[model samples]
Target: MDPIAPESADEVFLTAEEYEAVHAAVRTVAGSRGAGQPQTLNSLFEQWDELVHEVEEGYGWSAPELSNDLGCRTALAHVWRLLPPRVRAIRQPELDEIDRRFHATTVGWPGRDDQEGQWWLRRVPRHLEAETSQRSTHGWPMGWDVMAFPKPEAVEIAD
Candidate 1:
């Protein structure tokens, strides 16, 4: 058997059409499920049809002749889910990267004050160790206790 040569980047860079097509195929494959309550691999070929459409639509994809890359593997990631008694799967190192970069990016506390295009997020301090409110005592302060100290010099009694 002969060894296959690798695909050059010139052959596979993404185009707008390719983007749309691959997007559509991946979307379809992602959504496909079998008739079984749990579903199985029957939809994989259906998913492959999707992949073929994407390739034919020219998102810079040529049909796989001998070898492939993450793109094909990603398509099959969905396909793998559909396989009956499926054991094989592709592991994506970049799934971590994609999760890090893009997953749940829209999640966060919404601004408490959204006025005049300003979004102010409000958070209360969780716990303060040495916090206490001043007592509302109505009387003596610093001078009150000082009054107890002897008058510096009693004003000499007036004659």
Candidate 2:
């Protein structure tokens, strides 16, 4: 499906409530392991997976289930793009760390032969790029505007 962009530069894709929910979720996961210990790749992947599930449940956008890791990863990529810049700015460091670690450790994209790395680390960026291109060419995801900011009820006009 084609991606949808906001109608104008000033337009908002997600409401403040939605942004807060996602930001809170990121904070909870980022802090789940405590301060001193470094996060393992598995833990990072699991945390991101949980975020993806939360987004799917919260927004009622069914991309795929947890059983399909690749699908969930792809959905997360789209969700990542949907987040407001501020939220992404806060999390970019951690995300970059994940990418760096994954690159240092893994040979290539996770597959039947190389399943050691987090699929998201390698695949998500590609998805993000594709989403951006689609958004530029097409627009934001279908129904996102309505979902994010629903129109108010119409009143009857008197003659």
TM-scores, all models, native as reference:
0.18, 0.31
| Candidate 1 lDDT tens digits, 94-158 | 23333232212212123334232211111111111121232114211221122222222211111
Clashes of each: 4, 7
> Whole-model lDDT, candidate 2?
0.38
Q: Write the per-residue lDDT of candidate 2 for residues 1-159, one digit (tens) a residue.
A: 111221355543555665565644434444435576533323445565455444333322212332243433444454566555765665566566544553333233233333454444332111111122222112323222222222222211111
RMSD of 1: 28.0
Model 2 weakest 10-residue run by lDDT? 150-159
